[model samples]
Target: MRVEQIYTGCLAQGAYYIVSNGEAAIIDPLREVKPYIELLEKDGVKLKYIFETHFHADFVSGHIDLSAETGAPIIYGPNAAPEFDCIVAEDNQVFELGAVKIKVLHTPGHTMESTTYLLIDENGKDHAIFSGDTLFLGDVGRPDLAQKAASMTQEQLAGHLYDSLMTKIMPLADDVIVYPAHGAGSACGKNMMKETVDTLGNQKKVNYALNQPNKEAFVAAVTDGLLPPPAYFGANVAMNKKGYRNVDEVINQGMTALSPEEFETAAESTGALILDTRSNGEFAKEFIPQSVNIGINGDFAPWVGAMIGDVNQPLLLITDKGMEEEVVIRLSRVGFDNVLGYLKGGIEAWKTAGKETDQVDRISAEEFKERLKVGESVVYDVRKESEYEAEHVEEAYSRPLASINDWIKDINPKEHFFVHCAGGYRSMIAASILQARGYRNFTEIEGGFKAIAETGVPKTDFVCQSKVMKA
Candidate 1:
């Protein structure tokens, strides 16, 4: 028997492939299904089932497409009513895959249909549990995401999660391997461990949610600090539940290459947003006048989902020559399938064709410090609020990039300022958006706060001070 965790770093998501005796089962696949099909063909195994932990909100799962191609039944736990055909297995029901058995444990808290699949080896010994969002290595899934769908408050959902972990999960043996769906960088859970796989015993010892004394404590702890879910999350969930356009078709439509003239014409006619997916540095140097930059090298998909917010927004691409398909695929992962096409020869072609371009005024951190020494300068820190609260430049205002749309309106267009993220990736995204929206009186720090610190800039670290007073 072979069990492989196919981890995608960008999404911090894990899809599992398990095979035993020429039979295979896939768990929580990504939107792209070709690679999965190739793996099945190479292994000479028939795909017996596609298992979904829940209807995911972060990215569209490939269950529908994979099942359509391979004729494998898509398996879900009880209370799931997806638009497509699938086997809604009851709690404790087991399915045979050749020489091994996969038992369904209906652990529903992350979502009503959330489940963990227990793999029993040919020897009838429990091997591993593919604990979906129900349990992460250091944290359980956030309960807030399913509030609207389940008609339960986050506290109520957290109660269910506590029960799910206590009864369905904590009872497993210490040696049983735990494979979670997401890791640290995912928005699915707060405080997830970087490691994707861990032994159940280790989790029981270290995971906070698992060690809670009671359901009330568990609910309070889990729901304490959840930020609002990204705007595109609901749309992605809808697509996963109803069904979406075939990924192949989406790719084909997005891969259309257009000359600079044709690209301009299409953008004007369709009112598509121009998305430039180049390196941050390159994008900062020069790009089409109004194109928004969410560099492909960073947290591209999630950032796009957060910043753009509309899954059906028509987008035209400006990517490096060989990166067109990749940008399209990543966009599709977050359910942004209305890609019009790409700039045929990239920005170089646009420039060569005498099209106008724009550049952000970026200065090195040392230069920023020198300017600060000379006079007071407004600075905006684009890091998360937690990071900003921990430590930041003494007077830097926290304007987290994720909340740009909300706070941008308050930024006085005439007042000049400097913007920076931890290492400049997010600032570039902010710069692009600012420029696209016609606000240009700002400079972006070259290396962000990390560089600014090295230049001897005075910083403020948050300190909790309490004083005792006597009457």
Candidate 2:
């Protein structure tokens, strides 16, 4: 038996491939199904199942398309109300895959339909548990995401999660492997461990959610400090529940190469947002005016979902050469399927055609600190509220990137505000959005707060976040 955790770093999501004898099963796949198909073909295995742990909110799952292409039935846990055809397996039901068995453990905490799959090896010993969002290595899934769908408050869901972990999960053997759906950097859980796989015994000892002595303690622990789910999360969940355009069709429509003029005309006609997926440094140097930058190299997909706020927003791409297809695929992963096309020859083509371009001034963190010392600049710490409260420059404003749309209005556009995130990734994103909205006179700190902290700038640590609010 072979189990492979196909981890996508951008989404911090893990899709599992389980194979035994000549049969294979996929658990919680990404929107792009081509890679899974190729793997199956290469191994000469018959695709037996597409297992969905839950209707995910973060990225569009490939179950529908994978099933359609391979004739494999999509399986869900009880209470799943997907519009499409699927087998809703009951609790404790076991499915045979060649020499091994996968038992469904209906652990509905993350979502009403959330389930964990227990793999029993050919020897009939429980080998591993694919703990989908129900249990992360260091945390349990946040219960708030399913509050609306389950008609239960986050506290109630947390209670259920506690029961699921105690009854179904914690009873497993010490050596049983725990494969979680998401790792650190995912919003699915508050405190996921950086490691993707851990032994169940280790989790029981270290994971706060699992170590809770009572349901009340568990609920309070799990529900605390959840930031609002990204705006596009619900839409992605809807698409996953209903169904969506085939991955191939979406790619074909989006990967069209258009000349600079054609790209601009399509943007005008379609009112598509131009998304530049180049590196932060390159995008800061030059880009089409108003094109938002979420670099392909960083945490691209989740940031796209968080910032764009619309799954169906039509987008045109200005990607580095040979990156157009990748940008489209990543966009589709977050349910942004309405990509119009891409700039044919990238920004160089636009400049060659004498098109007006825009650039944002970027400075090293040291230079930003010098400016701060001279009282020549205002700092806008665009990291999350939690990050700012943890540590920030003494006078930096607490403008989070997640709520940039609302906060952008409160600040004067003409004022010079220096922006930074933990590192440079999110600050550049903030800078581009500000630029698109006609906010100039700002500089992006090259190394963000990490570098700023190193520069001996006056800094403060807040005992409570509310104390540091910037007006």
Top-TM-score structure, candidate number: 1
Model 1, poorest ten-residue lDDT window? 462-471
lDDT of 2 by residue, 280-393 (tens): 999888999988999999999999999998988999998989888988999999999999899899999999999999888999988886777435568888887867887888
Residue-wise C-alpha lDDT for candidate 1, range 1-471, written one tens digit per residue: 999999999999999999999999999999999999999999999999999999999999999999999999999998899999999999999999999999999998999899999999999999999999999988999899999999999998888889999998888899999999999888898778889999999999999888888888898888877888899999999999999999999999999999999999998999899999998889888999899999899899999999999999999999987999999999999999999999999999999999999899999999998888324688999988777776789888999898998899999998999999999999999999998998999999998989998998889864331110000
Candidate 1, residue 237: the lDDT equals 93
Task: Give the TM-score (vs. native) of candidate 2.
Answer: 0.96
Clashes of each: 0, 0
TM-score of 1: 0.97
lDDT agreement with native, every candidate: 0.92, 0.90
State TM-scores per candidate: 0.97, 0.96
